[model samples]
Target: MKAIQAYRFALDLTPARERDVLAHAGAARVAHNWALARVKAVMQQRAAERTYGVPDEQLTPAVSWSLPGLRKAWNAAKAETTWNGGRLLVAGRRYPSSKTCSGCGAVKTKLALSERQSECEACGLVVDRDLNAARNLAALAAEFDTAGSGPVGGRGADRKTPLAGQAAAKRQHGTAFAGQTGTVPPQGGTTNRVPVQAY
Candidate 1:
């Protein structure tokens, strides 16, 4: 049981809410993929250099996934690109207990990636396209209404998910890992966990 802090934003999107949401989420995805690609390239290159005895001039500067830094990058890009209004923001403090089923809110821990779009079996509720996760985050933020909590575990892109082997492996390459499917939040990204059904 860890202390987590969350911030909830009312999308307050008009009829065009969905469109804007998607655009913004896509921006997040772009940022994540861009960051991931750059990081992976450099790490792999450096590893190879170490193995092959390459020189220092060829290596690139290390990129960080710190929230403030990433937010700066996002805001700068947002002025020039298309994006959503309310991007998801979870501080990732206490193992973010999001559930599926929207109705029952049963916190299943090991929800698989195949269950991307979820249907709440207990409450006959349905959620998809990452909205479910967003709703859950909203509820969580309300529940943990506080501030100034330190970063939780496994929220950072670099910290969460062992990417080195998964992407590099022939079979696992490109395979979506748990908690890495949808657009990641500024503090904590989307998770492959159950949605809080019904509510």
Candidate 2:
């Protein structure tokens, strides 16, 4: 199996280079805000039509809020915004990169947007806000590389089932709790297993 890897390096930018970087960052922010505004406008328009009892087919066409759609819209309007060309990279929305400790898998429950630097309690690593997040992203990418394109082991492998008419892989429900000292009652009229508690 092929293993993927990534490396990250911190840049030491000259004053002019730093200014250019800041300019591009500002442009990216402007583009993102513009795209969000456009998406909101379309959504509001659709909602207004619904209030007017417009037929579903006759309603204003819905627009996608996905990155590609936003990128296309931004590209068309960037000229009007008077921003010279700058590539906009969209990071994943879900990762709490800035709030996570790059040195350890520790997550902070709360972090304010105003905090520009963070000190990781777990590893005593103090880093700039953006650099810390960039490091975390690099770490995440490295982890994904190691996982590779293969059937994962443990819970994932256990959860999989053979196609219809194929022989059972082996009853795993009972096996999951086989090491427990106490006896578990049978569930759903099937093999005995520990009851799964719903959160």
For candidate 1, the TM-score is 0.30
Cα lDDT tens digits, model 1, 59-121, are 544656556788988786664433322223445765434454445786555667667666666
lDDT of each: 0.54, 0.64
Instruction: Give per-residue lDDT, candidate 1, residue 80.
Output: 41
**When superposed on Cα atoms, how far off is each prediction in RMSD?**
32.4, 25.0
Q: In terms of TM-score, how similar is model 2 to the real structure?
A: 0.31
Best by lDDT: 2
lDDT of 2: 0.64
- Candidate 2, residues 126-198, lDDT tens digits: the string is 8898998998887765565432434342113334333343235554565434344555456545453344544
Superposed Cα deviation of residue 27, candidate 1 (Å): 31
